[model samples]
Target: MGASSNEAEEINDWELPNGEENKKIEEPQETTEVCARMDALGKLSSLIRNWEQNDVLTAVAVVGAVTTMAMAYSCF
Candidate 1:
């Protein structure tokens, strides 16, 4: 289910009208800034996930310790 050779040739031969091609292209600095922002967002998301996991684990440990202490005291 792909385009025929003649159709592909026709598509490849297409061109933008007048001076529109120059307007469509992005500046290199803008592209780099976008990429850097994406990377920073990715890193921030990862850090938050890890911090949440650590907090959950810490809570579980505290609960377990409290339960153990209560059981020990009840044995008196």
Candidate 2:
């Protein structure tokens, strides 16, 4: 004989429970903080934080972006 309907339903319940099918599973806040720290380790937030404390570095960044874009467009 072929598989019955209840067996198929049981298989789906084994994969995901009844009420949680439509709900999104979320991690706790402590896990979120740990993941954020791990993800940001190699980023340049330290430099950005220093630029926030100093105005000269921000101005240099803006000027560098404009000069680089100008040189790039000139070559095309």
Candidate 3:
């Protein structure tokens, strides 16, 4: 079964039920760390929090490409 035109349009727009619009909640910004190492660690933590599956796939692709290049170079 296929969705009707109205239903398809709603899905594309990501509209909520009852014609409600999405709202963004403001978050408090974090204070900057005085120490460089602490700031780096904080950024790393943030990266971990926002990590996604695509990042893992890209890392794997990089490793595979490097390995292939090394193997090809060794044949010279």
Error of 2 at 14 (Å): 99
Candidate 3 lDDT over 1-76, as tens digits, reads: 8999998877676646878666567997655654766889899999877978999789899999999999999999
**By the TM-score metric, which is better: model 1 or model 2?**
1
TM-score for each model: 0.33, 0.30, 0.41
Among residues 3 or more apart in sequence or in different chains, the pairs in candidate 3 whose N, CA or C atoms overlap within 3 Å are none
TM-score of 1: 0.33
* TM-score for candidate 3: 0.41
Worst 10 residues of 3 by lDDT: 28-37
> What are the Cα lDDT values of the candidates?
0.82, 0.75, 0.83
> What value does the lDDT take at residue 23 in candidate 1?
35
Clashes of each: 0, 0, 0
Candidate 2 vs candidate 3: the lDDT winner is 3
Which residue pairs clash in candidate 1?
A: none
Q: Pick the candidate with the highest TM-score.
A: 3
Model 2 lDDT, residue 53, Cα: 39
